[model samples]
Target: MPWLISCSAGYQKATNTSLATTFSNAVERFQRSYAFPGITASYVLPDGTSHSAAAGWADVENGQPMTSESRMLAASIGKTFVAATMVSLAQERAIDLDAPLSTWLGQNNWFQRLPNHRSLTIRQLLSHTSGLPNHVYLPAFVETVSERWPEPGNPFTPETLVRFVLDAEALFPPGEQWAYTDTGYILIGLVIEAITGRTYYEEVNDRFLEPLGLNATSASNKRRLSGLAAGYAAADNPFDFPVKTTDENGVMFWNPALEWTGGGLISTSRDLAKWGAAIFGGQGVSEEILNTMLQSVPIGDDMPGTYYGLGISIFRSGPLSPVFGHGGWIPGYSSSLRHYAESGITIAFQVNSDRISHQSLSEIELCLARVVISSGEKTDCVP
Candidate 1:
């Protein structure tokens, strides 16, 4: 229902490189353009050389400085985490990407109203092509049930999220159209629970977070993370309230049930980058499963530059370089984790304020890309 915001620092050196000036200039420009409360950036090159930097505040109200260890709401960027979990399951033979979900949920009668609902596979869910509408769109349900929910100190269970999706109508037949449905990922958490008999949070922690040593990150049920910045929204009534607590806005509430697999995990830039490297480097899953997770699936012509692949979006560069990874946003956060597979380099950006639009972020990202491309060691240049 809400996007997760996060950023990763860059630290990598090309075989024969010189991009320090370009990288510095790009970060300077991004800081100026957004006036972001804080930023943490890291990049790792193919050759094992890297660089990382931090700028801005981790907590604006308290004037806390942003750090590599400062945790932030990852927003929807958590989808990749969901994706990674499923990928691990696939490797372990607990789930099959091509198998229908009805195998796990049971009974075609429940979803029989929707054509091909039973035929929908876990893979489709991962790629957001199952054609399910966002369950959070039901205003009545969000107002009543969500209002009764707790605050950041408490997180909703994924089962609640699954119930919401099961009650909603499918957007289209499985694999028929593309809509970035939080329902798909919510279902993913369900599948994990159904098999493991553990909470989605625990599964993620035991399987991915703990092994990776991501001590400062979690689904963040509030409780003032050690160095987390408070997220800010553009305010429903700007004159009356320039920025509001995410809790005031039901959609902005940090209910794990609201986002589930789609958006919910909180993470720091350092941990986010570590997770990124783990995914790209094939640390946890088999090569084949990772390939499926990264392969692009068609989203039809309506959604430009939006292609679903496993748990991430394969954003084709309109005029810039091709990038892979998902973007997430919640009430007070906007974030993205992208990497160039060919170059073995990654870029993560997270902001505490959602007032900055995606278009603006894209422009800023393009400028950053230009810096990375132009300043890296050129193959054409003779050594």
Candidate 2:
């Protein structure tokens, strides 16, 4: 309650309005516009005050009302955790970021078969400069998943997922061009596992979740933690074909193992906001490593002023100042985690509908940013 009160006070002092009231109104507007089953958002202001808001039903069929604490799949936001863990390991000399991944995971048959696999480095994989094909986007992989989806208990291993892109041509020579590929992260996970001789889940749990006390976050697909929000997709969209119902029960349609390191973690908005504050605020890792993670690669004109960093996206061209974070989509969930460096604010939100597009998500972020900027001290809003 104090947190909420502080947020309201902060907003009133800056904008002469109540933050909770305006935030709740914004959530309602987004819910009505997107028709999402639920939407949850949390934030940490420049002054370290925390606030959260939720709207709609976490489980539409069950009529469970959504709360700000609802846990949901965070998709590629999990990649930030992976990047942090790897960077920490690099600091420990457990692995080298620029070392060829083949040094660690070369024994695997899949690695031996992929072109330039021996030359791909950890840095390249993290930044999506490895020219690896994104298995989830490949037509054959899509067809296969479409045919086999919603099958209960059907899971895929990292090796199995990597095989989907094994024979496909590279996007470009390694480090010569930038592309986004989940397969690269899959390899990164394997390398992490190989170096530590422990499952990637274990490393992340110890390196991040435990130290940060992020009890609600999990890296595995097998743990059936309670209170997880139901996932939903568009029933009317052809792209969401063969998924007859919006229901996205894990046993029915999702195999968290398939997403693995690329897009497979579950967390609440509160936990994600905490993570954004810690990781981007330099509490989660060394300042040097955080800087490395923030370093950007030119993504070209298709995405002007946008760049992809270690595990997050950077945007510097908008009306707002430079902001960095990642967005993610699984079948029934979409999530975003962002940090406004100039304002020292972090916003983490998730909707239970993958039907929402990136552009829509950006609009939502912009809306929230405007409120935060308006609600903060004038100096905090200065670019």
lDDT of 1 by residue, 1-383 (tens): 02222223243444333575455445544655568777766555545445555677656766667666656678788888888887787778756788878777665344444335668888888887888776656565466454554444343454554555565666787877777777778778877777778888898889888987867668755443445566776766222223633432223334433555677777765566667766776775668877878777767787677677887777675644367777777666777777766556666767777778767667555544544544443312110
Q: Where is model 2 poorest over a 10-residue stretch in terms of lDDT?
A: 1-10
Candidate of highest TM-score: 2
Candidate 2 accuracy as TM-score: 0.89
What local distance difference test score does each model get? Answer: 0.64, 0.78
lDDT of 1: 0.64
**Model 2 clash number:** 0
What RMSD value applies to candidate 1? 6.3
Q: Which candidate tops lDDT?
A: 2
**Tens digits of per-residue lDDT for model 2 on 291-376?**
98988798877988999889988988875769988988877788988898887889888998887766678777867766665563
Model 1 earns a TM-score of 0.81
